[model samples]
Target: IDMLHWMSRAALEMIGRSGLGYSFDSLDEGGKPHPYSVAIKQYLPTVSEFHFCREYVLPKLRQFLPPRVCRLALDFIPYKKLHKLRDVVDVMHQTSIEIFEAKKKAFEEGDRAVRAQLEEGKDIMSILIKANSEAAEGDRLSDEEVIAQVPFRTFTFAGTDTTSNALSRILLLLSTRPKVQDRLRAEIAEAISTYGEDMTYDELVSLPFLDAVCRETLRLYPPASLSSRVARRDVSVPLSTPIKGIDGRKMDSILVPEGTKVYVSILNANRDSTLWGPDSYEWKPERWLSPPPQVLTDARIPGVYSNLMTFFGGGRACIGFKFSQLEMKVVLSTLISQFRFSLSKEIEWKMTGVATPWVKGSSVPKLPLTVELLEAV
Candidate 1:
């Protein structure tokens, strides 16, 4: 919990510093809550209201009304409530505007001296601002549009928790599997020693064992269990091998008609014994060391990962794949180098079917590993 909190705070501070030249100081120096976080927190109530409307109110209303009537009722629901929701959204917009104006004014007032003193002006938001200023009017995002992205403040919350949870799981596994952990530690140590104090992107990307560890873990237990998509047209997805259907007929394809809602079972596909080998259920990174067998490597499989649909594939795949991978590697290396991790208690991880797995009970483990601080050579 502490690690996750710190990571979230750190990611937020880093994103703020790098993206907008603003510092929340949520991690390093213990900075106070910035307007961004404040604005984001304000939207939580509104989101809850939306959830309440969808889950409780709407369903209850539907019990006595026909489907079409329910639809009309929802449409007829007072615009006043929506307008109120818009007002809450406006707070976020206003806050973003304040941040942008402050930044713009700083840049305009020959405040390059201040920027230089900070040594942190080249962040994502700064770059975006620069681009926005330079671009043609039609190409640029309006202040309102830019402000609407205030919810992105929650990215830190989402990214940090998910990634840290994944890292923690990997550490737990490593601690139990001493041999595997030793191999990984040795691989990382060799890389660092070979590269000296400075590890370049190319060097980091080339760490095969580390990469395999991450891939294998994600394959066995993806943070996200399911993903949904709406079909654009009637489509047929071909199967690698025919399966006997209820009619006792060999079925090679499944027909998905237009507008059909599809939920792809990512976890199921990743661990499918048919796609993977006999030891598919096992967590073996070495399996990824060689080219996957012909059956698994078929192009028809939609996996952003190694013949597994952990990150999905094709046009809708995550754009942050490279970024996430780099972050994971960096964090794992740093932590492993600092201390040894071990399991606090014998427990099974509960699947939440969300982006990250949560322990079954409220009493989630704090990764009570014995942190044996490494000695300097």
Candidate 2:
């Protein structure tokens, strides 16, 4: 829990400093619970309630209740009950706007001198804001619109938990495999020793074994399980291999009408033996080191990650792929070098169909682990 929380805080701070010239001070000050965090926490439950109404209550109510009746029902609903929801959302939006306004004010008052000094003078947000200001009116995002997206600017949730969970899982697997862990540790040590004080981006990217381990972990247990897409036009997707239909007849293709919802199962595809060979189910980084079989690399399988779709594929693939990889490597290196992690207790991680898997009990649950500090040579 501590590691995950810290990682989350660090990632958010990093994103803020890199993506924007603002620092949330999440890391340096122990991320002391601020209004923003409180607002976020309160807003989520309210939003969940609103969505629940739309998905469950509203739909069922519409079946029998007339629009006028529904309106009357809402009128009777306690204002106090709804006020909590509205207050939180309002605070969140207001805080975002306030922050954006502050940035703009800083820029106009002193040419962003204040922000430049604080952010080391090279934030992506500043660049974007400048570009947006210089661009044609139609092509640029307004200051208000840009500020409105402040809540989404740092990807606070994703930046924090996803990489940490992935690293935790990898460490757990390594704990079980002593030989593999030792080998990897040795590789890391050798690389560091050879490269001198700091590891460069090129050196990190060139670490084939580390890359393979990260890839393998992502393959076996992708943080994200399912991705959704809607068909733009009527299309027929032919199966690479025939499947026996309910009528016991071989079917080659599935007809998808326009506007049809399609879900691509990334987890299942990652483990498909036909695409990944007999040992597809196993967590073996060696497979990544060697060339995948011709069949697996064929165009039939479209995956941005190891021809297995961990990050999805093509134009719709994750824009943050490189950023995510670098973040993971840096965090993994830092943790592994500093400490040795082991499973604290034997517990099964429950799966969810969301972008990332979570434990069964709560929305943001912790993975328990015991750790020991490594001695400096």
Candidate 3:
């Protein structure tokens, strides 16, 4: 089975429900996909066609042109891929507006109306809308700002692909290592026996093997392998250890000029031999099962999670890191408890914002795995 395809659908459904109190996918095999899902699936690949524009042209344009002027200019530009991207953005934006309007109307209609929605008005967007309604007038978000919060577009696009890809990587790793999979399954089974099949958030996240497996997969193969940041001001970043410069002098720090665009290599940082020891490249969940080595701790990796750069760090750290972790753990716990996954085909991971698995020589993203149902643990 191609796990990537199904995982993408599942990820969309998850974010749709939890983030927007909506559903973009039923997740039934061969079911008709939601329009939003269709648009979003096309979004990343289509945008990638214009990587030069997104990385360079757009940035320069934004500095000189108003957003409205730039948006208007797209209509005059006769690029097919650009037009396709515009159409995709339109679909996502329109959907966001519709969802926002519905939620706003429900909020204005009183508690009974709010209680009648799909999520019973408890999803993140609903909670935000409620809070916005009750906040002081000066603190209220504008309609446009609230609409932008709709997961149909921004949240779904940001959270779905990265998460699904990460989950795919974890499953792929487990498939190649049966003993590790069995051990994780046993740990989950024990947890289920103690906490019931439906474990609480605290109980679920507190699982040692499950957490280790996730952290290990994320460390070895971060979905978003690179992150870019512009220095807000000239700053000196201290290195964990001094490095020999071209002059043969030790340099413990580097001065980042103001406004310099820095591309942080998350993959390299996570797998650095110096910081994580020589075996850093290996996938060993047991590493996280114990306290991290002193060198790693003292390295003070700037990432927001587990001293790894998978989620970036500081103020711009991924807002969905916790949510993504919870989602992965829940999916892993449920799937591993009832199914067995084994490698079925040769696959390669390609980096395109998110790392995606593909059958060797195939252009499409896919991960074929042998999955077996477990009658009983």
Model with the higher TM-score, candidate 2 or 3: 3
Question: Which residue pairs show collisions in model 1?
Answer: 18-123, 18-124, 19-124, 19-125, 25-31, 223-355
Whole-model lDDT, model 2: 0.68
Per-residue CA lDDT of model 1 for 301-320, tens digit only, reads 77676677877888877545
- Give candidate 3's root-mean-square deviation (CA, Å): 2.2
Clashing pairs in 2: 8-160
Each prediction's whole-model lDDT (CA): 0.66, 0.68, 0.87
User: Candidate 2 on 1-377: residue-level lDDT in tens?
Assistant: 34444554555566666655667665654447445555543444355457557656887989998977976665467877576765675675676677667776776677557646534556655665666657897898977667644334345433444565576677768767767776777778888889954899999778888888899999988867777687999999999888999999999999999988799998999898887889989999888888878887684678766676777887778656667778888777767766777655553554432222233464554555667888998
TM-score of each: 0.75, 0.80, 0.93
Cα error, residue 285 of model 1, in Å, equals: 1.5
lDDT winner between candidates 1 and 2 = 2
Residue 47's lDDT in candidate 2: 56
Error of 1 at 295 (Å): 1.5
Candidate 3 per-residue C-alpha lDDT over 1-377 given as tens digits, one digit per residue, 9 for 90 to 100: 88887788888899989888888777878797777777766777788788887888898989999999999999999998889999999998898888888878866866475656633566888787778878999999998887776454456788988898899999999999999999999999999999999999999999999999999999999988888999999999887778999999999999999999999999999999988888998999999978998988988888899999999999878888999999999999999999999999999987766788989999787899999999884
Q: Judging by TM-score against the true structure, name the best candidate.
A: 3
Runs with alpha carbons beyond 4 Å of true place in candidate 3: 109-111, 115-120, 150-154, 244-249
Count of steric clashes across candidates, in order: 6, 1, 0
